[model samples]
Target: AVNLAIAFAMQGHENKVGLLDADLHGPCVPTMLGMQDQKLKVGPIGAFPALGPLGVKVVSMAFVLAGKEVPVVWRGPLKMRAIEQFLSEIAWGELDFLLIDLPPGTGDEPLSVLKLLPEMDGVIIVTIPSEVSQNVVGKAITFAKQLNVPVIGIVENMSGFVCPDCGKETHIFMKGGGKKIAQEYSVPFLGSIPLDPRVCEASDMGHPFIMEYSDSPASKAFMIIVKKIKAFISERQS
Candidate 1:
């Protein structure tokens, strides 16, 4: 989600973007974007999100927590209220796109987001090239459809691994699961992101892989996925 947000933000300044880290249980967006020490600036009107790379406004529970070690152990009502405040109270300010990073499940947080923001454009379900992960894709699509929300597409992450020395790509997790699942469920397969060690390293160091390693195979795949998403939105609008 952080990579996609930064990628879209990289499309020059005209397209403004905001990232809402709605994964209440695990708010990693701030840590991934190197905003661990930042906090939301609350004024009389509302709270202002922290400015991330390429001018992407960001809001996460990580920003309000006492520390990274602190846990958010709240009930459903509390969580719903917090998410509601995050949506309506934050001063996002003229966003061309607001991407909500949801937890991997059809749970309270995801349900709350969909229920609150009925106008959400769609959801891009990300899955790894594994049967277990692919199983979740169907559930996610059904969840969205049941809520009358559109399933934008599916993105396959860590699809392959390329040996740096030999330059040969290996399907470490098994090949073509993403495309196969997309076909099975009749949804668009955006692209496959090769497993790059640098992607993990960059994330740990609060850097977006696309910006840090644009020439890498994984980064190139991300660019392609972003373009496909824009195309999907364009087609819908037209």
Candidate 2:
């Protein structure tokens, strides 16, 4: 996966796109984008790669501490600096959308983002379609609401699976869990994605779902969600 989900994001628009991996604890975008071997240089000017796409840029802790399994193990201040470096020092280059993959939960990352960009467009929450997953996301939603950050919508991943033999729908994780949360929050329910083996297969092969299996239901779901995201954001900007 070339992270074209980030690429598809800029489709038909002449705007800038920034894919920020705020998941300090488990920053996987580097591995996901196949840029894990690349090193990032931090200079007095700022921290950024010397080469990449024009409008599309990525920054993540995975880039900073590449090939290392050491935990960040920092307090709020260190996390704050990392977030600051990502936003202020990095050459974001006039982004229209900064898709931040925040570390799960209502911890330092989300708080730092809220503090850094008080007028942020909003957050797109991701969760598996399960009661336990929804419960945890609900807590995050509560924190966001308390801090006054509107949730653009919820992206339901791993909603259900299809039986290859009989071609019947299986409620692997049960269904409608994401809609329940969206209804509770009064935010738009973007869409649901199935547990396609191709999704995991593509990721293992270093290809994102949108790239490998664009015709898959999961990819179709993402396309719809992307449109909803664009519309929701446009409304917010207006």
Candidate 3:
């Protein structure tokens, strides 16, 4: 959800936007956002102060835990409370969006996020091209609908492989599962992102592709996706 948050922020929404990484088991947003070093100071009333009122804010169970590398061994309620701390405790003044990135499945993390924010504006489902991913997301959509949350759109990440020298492309992750799913559910197909080597490089160097290489094709596509999100938000908010 860091991508979504940063993208929204880049689209000129200067207001505060918080990202809660409910994936306690696999928290990557902290490292991805280059906010790994700061100690997550959770207040007695659950207020985390570093994330300012109008800047981009992020919180995760991994950040709040003893150590990011240490295992978060806990049951359902325990996990739920941690999610609560990340949500209720954070001092997100006002937000254009609170992009909560749940782990890529219908597990405790996602369950906790849904239960925590039942009135979420919308969920932008991210997935690669595969039956496994699509099948699981069908369940996710059904569950989201069950909780009365809308499926805003589907983002097909790593949808194609970009050639290094010639600029050719290949749908290495199976096929157009995103389009099929979008068609099936009557949701918008936001955009497709080709797998670029630079994206991995940026991740390794601790920056997201959009910020690192804003002019790359993948970055441009990311910007377009952000535009789509902004349009969606504008239309919905109005």
Kindly indicate the candidate among 1 and 3 with the higher lDDT.
1
Worst 10 residues of 2 by lDDT: 1-10
Candidate 2 residues 1-238, lDDT tens each? 1333444543653336678788888877766655676677777778774233333467878787736687888888899888888888886666676777787788898899988988888887888888889778889788878888888888788888898789998888888989999998787788898888877676666555575666777877877788888888789889
- Per-residue C-alpha lDDT of model 3 across residues 1-238, encoded as one tens digit per residue: 6666776777777556777777878888777766676667756655673452236777766566677668877888988888887777677767777888888878887888887788777788888888878888788788788888778889988878878888778778878898899899888889887788887776666576677677877778788988887788678879
Candidate with best lDDT:
1
Sort the predicted structures by TM-score, highest score first.
1, 3, 2
Q: lDDT (CA) for every model shown?
A: 0.89, 0.75, 0.76
Tens digit of lDDT per residue, candidate 1, span 1-238?
Answer: 9999988887653338999999998998988888899999999999999998888899999988888899999988999999999999999899878999999988999999999988888999998898877778889999998999888899999898889899898888888888999999899999998899998899899998889999888888888888888888889889
Candidate 3: TM-score?
0.91
Q: Which candidate gets the maximum TM-score versus the true structure?
A: 1
Instruction: List candidate 2 stretches off by more than 4 Å.
Output: 1-4, 13-15, 42-44, 49-55
Q: State TM-scores per candidate.
A: 0.96, 0.89, 0.91
Candidate 1: C-alpha lDDT = 0.89
User: Better model by lDDT, 1 or 2?
Assistant: 1
